[model samples]
Target chain A: MRTFSAVYCEWFKLDEKRYLDEVKRSANSHSPFIYPTMELLNENLDNFINHQEETVISFSQLTQYLVMKLAHENELKVLLDGQGADELLVGYDYMTGYYLNQQLRSLNLKSFFEELLTVIKRKNVEGLQLLSYHFSPNFLRKKILYRNKKYLSNRLNNIISQDNFYLSPMYKSKSLTTALIVNVDYKLEKLLR
Target chain B: MTFGIETRVPFLDFRLVVYLLSLPDEYKYKKGTTKRILRDALNEYLPELVKQRKDKIGFASPDFKLLKELDEKHWS
Candidate 1:
């Protein structure tokens, strides 16, 4: 239940006072806030790169590494985070834009899917290319049937017997379903990597 | 896993993820607000200031600035 935060100096202006104050206020009852200085972070990153023989690491990766190090040093064996919420909830502005654009053209599923495909290709984010297939109802149906042959075969009987099952709202809209599926696929690939 | 400290994401919990994914697009993002559902759900618990904050700085660091300074100092 402990919370750890890395605070930057005022010169950075990245950590606003309001956000930091809120973070401090929300700390768990017994949790201590750990603030690692920029110099310490730099040293840690340098040491990590030298030890691992890596030339570069992303800012996010570096931050995670430092947080993990701090947790290990503090003897905190486990920590809970709020990751993956962004992907699931469309927290990214770009994702929101994509979803809204798709919704606007919901009347024509084909053109909507085509436009989405074009956008995905233009953006060229990983695992997005696979998303195009899901947009095509025919392709998705075939893929699902092939991939879940046993499940599909028993779906008829299960549907008849399972009275408590609830269909997700995502299934009602093709665009939303595609967006969620694509996001999940992209996140899964990132996690695997 | 690199530092031997295990980090679990509760947001990625199976049931929670399913429910969140099922929400309408507007619930997720509306107008200019992102994570609308999360903000609303935590509004009562979180400070009003925090709830109203709009900035989303993800893993931002000043190391780049430091590096630039060092480069300039050395070159100059």
Candidate 2:
């Protein structure tokens, strides 16, 4: 992962593994393979859950929370995060789907094919998956993916099946501009919180 | 949010975001490259390796391996 490699790019007195381990530990005390016991993991999970006051299956926020905790411990009272660039600039790899869809809708064959070939060469199957997801209906896609165990916990899938919960403004976006705007209004807003 | 630290995001400034949003799509992504303008604008300040790097990993931890090693009972 680029994050792991970025750690290696820095000057370090310790060996690579040790340096990474230290970095991970600083970000999250219960980072896997760094701590010797599960007690810290359980304790941190409970602490995170209580502090967040919401149900979240994803632990990505916990990693960030722990990083802030580290900052707090070091007496750092303010931090500047590079968080909104991806949503604003459409910098994420999966975002190719939105861009490609826009190009196809506008009948920009040259741009579409050019980008498609590059994505196929670089990302292979993952690029194809992004394209399929963009073209598919939101509910149908979630149903198929959940049935195939591609994502979502079984309990959450059951809840989804029972409710009308699949609608998102993002699926209706007809251009990359609209998609970026939606992401900023919805996804990035959550992250910035 | 409860760590008593104030977090700021300069990129999310309304003025900057509005400006970026107004740009054409190709300005953000071209061919296979993402963040086209950012890379181009920061080309001089960024190292060659960073400028050329395609892969980006954002605030991600090794959660899959950790969950695999964790006991199933932990979830219950």
lDDT of 1 by residue, B10-76 (tens): 8777788788878777797644456789898887777777777554545666656655654465435
Residues A62-115 of candidate 1 have per-residue lDDT tens digits of 666776777787888878877787777765534543554455555656654654
Could you tell me the interface RMSD of model 2?
Answer: 5.2
Error of 2 at A189 (Å): 3.3
Inter-residue clash pairs, candidate 2: none
Give me the runs in candidate 2 sitting further than 4 Å from their true place.
A1-40, A124-127, A133-140, A143-153, A158-167, B72-76
Return the lDDT, model 2, position A29. 42
- Pick the DockQ winner: 2
Task: Give the per-residue lDDT of model 2 (tens digit) for A1-193.
Answer: 1121212122322114444454454445433322212445666887888898976544466756666766676667777778889888877776777777778889999988998888887764444555676678765665433342224577775776544233346645667788788778776647668
Give the runs in model 1 whose Cα sits over 4 Å from its true position.
A26-38, A50-57, A107-177, A189-193, B70-76
| Backbone-clash count (model 1) | 0
Q: Which candidate gets the maximum lDDT versus the true structure?
A: 2
Error in Å for residue B8 of model 1:
0.7
The RMSD (Cα, Å) of candidate 1 is 13.3
Best by TM-score: 2
Candidate 1 positional error at A179, Å: 2.4
